[model samples]
Structure formats: C-alpha cells, structure tokens
Target: MPGRPHLIPGLSAVPPARRLGSSWSRGVVASAAACLVLAGCSSTITIDDHDLSDADRAACEALVADLPGTLAGKDRVGVEPADALGAAWGGRASYVLTCGVPEPEDYEPTAECSVIEGVGWYVPDDQLTDPAEDATPVALSRTPFVEVLVPAEHRTEGIDRALAELAPVLEEHLGEGLSCL
Candidate 1:
C-alpha cells in the first residue's frame, strides 16, 4: 500500500486541484492570447473627410465628441486620417458615419424618409426596397447633413438599433427642426 498509487473508484490519481490548476490555467492563457491576436487584427477604418464650412466643422466635431463608445453592439474603432469628420464601429462588418456631407442628388421635397428619435433619415428608394443590397446609405434630412453607411449583414434590426441609438445625439447637435414630414 505504501508504494502503490492511491485511486478512487471513478476518478484519476491526479487531485482535483492539480488538474484544475494545470488545464484551467492553460485555457485562460490561451483565451487571453486569442483576444490579443483578434485585437491586433482590427485595423483602423478609413473614412474620407468631407469639406465643411467653419460652423459645420465645429458642430460636426462636437457631434463626434459626444458619440457613444459603442453602436449596435459593436465597439467604436478608430478612423484613418485622424481628424476626418466621422467615426466608425466594428471590423469586417463596420458602420461609418460621416458628417457635413452633401445632400443626395435624387432627394426631393417629397422623398420617403424614416424618423427615429426625432431625426429624419432618408435611404435611396432602391436600397430601401431591395433585400439583397449589401449596404444601406442613410442620410440625415437636416443641415450639417450626416450620412451613415450600414452593412446589410446587420439587417433591419441592427440598422434600426443603430439609428435609435444615434437619434438623440443627432437631435442634440443638429437641432430638432425639420424631421421627416
């Protein structure tokens, strides 16, 4: 008995503490390494800077400053050219918001629009009706126009959630007047 290994009826000779310490610690380390790798893989998103007048630039800056840290369950990511008038979120399926953009060429006084949280957003007719489109470009229907490009992968739920999350912020900075009529 003194020289023989101690064993339980249905368990290994290794103690629970020792087994957990070795395998659990390895698992934790592996998880941490994977997180680091994924973080490193996220590259900065590039967004083109829009030409803005002095007033529009200041307002856009303020709006950018107040943007939420996360949008539609995605963490905010850096935008390239550092001082571009926009912010982005996510990696592969990202959403980009650009401020001070020109009005859409086809926008008419009677164009269809959706109002979210006191903000009016206009999506082109084709994109609005088509379910196969990969991306939807939504433009704010007010001054200091803002545009958000939402990937279709997010679907209607993601788009609606993102717009709802952004609506209050847009209203605060862009004013509450002239929402979708």
Candidate 2:
C-alpha cells in the first residue's frame, strides 16, 4: 500500500502543514475545540475506544497500567464504558490516550520523529480523521503503537507534558528508542 504523504520517509525534519485551507481540516480543529469545552469540568470523559487484536490488547493493558494519575497538571478523569486501553486527563480531558493502535501503513522509519525526554513518537502531519470530535491521533513509535488523542487547544505545551509524563511508562513497558534527530 502507498504510504500516507504526511509520514516522514526517513529521519528528517518536520513536514510542512498540508491541509491549511481545507474545510474538513477546519472541521477537525473545530470539533476538537468543542470537545474541550464540553468535556471541561465533567468528572467522566467519554472515549470511543479502539477494537484491538488480542495481542495488542494485552500490550495496551501493560502500557496503560503505569499511566500517571495526572498529566499536564490536569487530574485523570474517568472514562465511560472503560474496558478499552485508554485514559483522559485534565478537567475537560485535554488529553486522551489510547493504546494498541496499529502502526500507520505509511509508517516511515526515517520520519523526523519527536522525542519527549526519550520516548520517540510518530506524529503524522495529517492525524487520522476520528468520528469522535476533538480526538487527534498521535502514534507511539513502538510495537503495538499506542495512540494519544490530544485536544487542539492543548497542542504544544499540553502535548509535551503528555509525552513527558508517558515516556517512562512506554519505556518501562514497551522499550525505548532514540528520537529521529
């Protein structure tokens, strides 16, 4: 299969933004924003969980076991129908993380990956178009690829915090790799 254009072909710098003026892109951003507002202050956050293979499910369970109680200064919130491998943090679930995601078919080993503290991430420029509003998928560059859905409102700083907080868990459970510097 053809790799997604947004994927880095090799260890390279960040890719330029692709859907700057696309209407659907805008909708994605808007949807994420809406989720932030609606979920803010809610004790439990709703998660559209992933259906993972048995092996991936087991791996996800291992990865989520060590998730911190709070992230980016927001306390962890409850997830409804919470059997899936996932977690939400912040008053409005500014950050939502799900494990056991499949590696992007366009996975590029040479992509200019980001390393938070030490964990490497495959941040696809065009995140998956999730039906659930406010869910942006960021893949952990490891076996069984974990995906974290971060609110658009919490892009840089919030994202950094989420990665930093989760790095240890990932490394401990899934092993670690150096950033594609």
Candidate 3:
C-alpha cells in the first residue's frame, strides 16, 4: 500500500493502483491537497509518447484535433511535448487519453466489451485498478486503438460521459469498424 502514485513522474500520496469494481473509501486520497503537494503536479501531466508509424501518427492527429477541452467536468491540462498525441484533464487525480495505441494482446471474443457511440471498447477485467473512486482505464478495441485512463472518482458515469463526447470524433475520424474481440 504505497501512497505515491506510480505512473506519473511527480505526484505525491496518489494511490499506486486503482482497485476496480471497488469503492474509493479505502483511504486512497480524499482531498486534492494531499495528492497535489508537488510543485508541478497541478500544472502538467506526463505521458510516455508511443513510437507510432506514419499512418498511426496521421490518425492520432485527427483524433487529437477534435479532443474536447474539458472532460468529466475537468479542464484540459497541458502536457510537456505540445505535439504529443495525448490529452490530460484535472490535477493530481486526472483523466489521461492517448491515441494510436496497439491492439490488446489478450483480446477475446468472450471478453467484456462496451459499445458507446458506435465504438467498441474492450474492457480489461484483470488489469482494472480503481486507485481511488473514479480511476478506471478503458481501452478502445480498434487498430491504432485509444486508451483512456480515467480518474478514480468519476467511475463508470464519467467513462460514459467521456465516451459520449469522444465516440463521434473517433468514429468520424478513425472510422467505427471496430468490433468485439
């Protein structure tokens, strides 16, 4: 039960893992002050850029162009590299989205898949961690897939809302040929 956040570069007291399908009442992080104690934690979010091919890069550009400024009621925070095909919202407990991800290796036809806005999302059952109340990571099941790392507090409701906003953009730009499994 380490209190420091694992994925990011600079965040203090943020949970190391999100316990999906569980409640955030496990003393993960209740207040913003506890997680946002670092100097630059509140200002930026760090995302490891993927080495995308030319086509993937083009697709990522299309997806990034239409990304909404706000998601799940949080304003978009800037990342270090301006050209990165990723977006982040909120402070310590933030929502992170990256376009042009590779398809899931463990994808199965029987796996849990959710369709939102005509987009098929491969729900990862084993890797899900609710770090807090709203942090749930959902993956899009398409070539040049998209990965959205949701905050621990927003829960499924927030994912629904975010998908509602992102679905159309993904469909129009990336095409909605993605299917389950």
Candidate 4:
C-alpha cells in the first residue's frame, strides 16, 4: 500500500484504472454492478412454494421495524445501522429473516465471504413469554443460510439479492402451527 493510493475498507487497495473521486464511490459502483451475478447464483438457491399467512407477514414487518431503530444507535462499540449495509426482509413464515455479513462459522482468510442466515425464532420471543422480554435471541435455521460469497467490495449487491430470494422461501417453509411473529 505504500507507493499505491489507499482505498476504502471494501474497495480494492490498488487504484482502479478509471478516474474516481474517492475510493468509496468506486467501491459502491463496482459492488452495485455485481447484482448481475445473481443470475448465475440462481442455480444454488432452491425455491419452493412455502405458504405464509397474513398474520405472519404482519408480525414480520412489526419485528423488522424494531430492528432498524434498535440497531442503528450508539452502542459501546459505536453507532451502527439497524440494517446491515445491504440487508432486506425475506423468507417464509415471517420468522425467516436473513442478514448480510460473513457467517461467523464460514469466515476464512481466503474468502471474502458474507452470510445470510434465517432465524427460526428471534430470541426471547422463541423462549421467554412473560409478554415483555427482549425477544431477539433467535434460533438459526434455513439451509446453509450463507448465500454465495463474492468479493467483499461487491458484498452489498450480492447480499441484497440473497435477502430478496429468501423472502419467498418463508411461505414455502411455514408449518401448520408455526409462529414466526
């Protein structure tokens, strides 16, 4: 990194051949273009006809509303956005949600990985029922919720598609009495 220009965290350390104002914009553009990669990734994700009820969707939206506000605040570490840099609500049964980041288990030095996992149950909601406990501890579910890994710079785009794809699976996985909300 000495003789070369420095870049943003997710951008390439080496400068792009084209002119760019700053490393940030270059990285964002590069990553956004990676959305096209989703077509090829389509072969990897299995789709189904999971059926979710209206109540489930309602519960999910309500649950999501809380996360963005709750997560986007100054914590001890620092302020962070509720939604991952590129995250969306998807999956069946409303309980099935995915996030964009490397799954703690799948991280490796060789891979610029990101994880999108579905929580079968979110925290106290899945456990405590005093009607007033922090219901965030969710049980992890969904198949290898780590949807395809791409360059860290393009993770936002890849992750966005992953979340979009996961939404449909929610209904496909819903069961008779399963409560996701």
Query: What is the number of backbone collisions in each predicted candidate, taken in the order shown?
Result: 0, 5, 13, 14
List candidate 4 stretches off by more than 4 Å: 1-50, 69-181
Error of 2 at 160 (Å): 1.3
User: lDDT per residue, candidate 4, 18-54, as tens digits?
Assistant: 1111111211122222332454421111212123356
- In angstroms, the error of model 1 at 75 is 0.2
- Model 2 off-target regions past 4 Å? 1-34, 37-43, 126-137, 175-181
Ranked by TM-score from best down, the candidates are 1, 3, 2, 4
C-alpha RMSD between model 1 and the true structure: 20.0
Q: What is the lDDT of residue 103 in candidate 1?
A: 74
Q: Which segments of candidate 1 are over 4 A away from where they belong?
A: 1-42, 176-179
Model 2 over residues 47-83: C-alpha lDDT tens digits? 5556777776777788777789988788888776576
Off by over 4 Å in 3: 1-40, 127-139, 176-178
lDDT of prediction 4 = 0.27
- Which candidate, 1 or 4, has the higher lDDT? 1
Colliding pairs, model 1: none
Residue by residue across 1-181, what tens digits does model 1's lDDT show?
6754544343324323222111111111122123324655444655666777898889888898999999989998887668877887877425678878777777777765665555667755555444434444444555688877665455544665677788778877874333443
Cα error, residue 179 of model 4, in Å, equals: 14
Rank by lDDT, highest first.
1, 3, 2, 4
Over the stretch 1-181, how does candidate 3's per-residue lDDT look in tens digits? 3654443222112232332224222212223323345565456655557788888789888888788898868888886478778777776546677777666677666665555555666645554533353443344555577877655556544655676577767776674434563
Q: After superposition, how far is residue 143 of candidate 4 from its true place, in Å?
A: 15
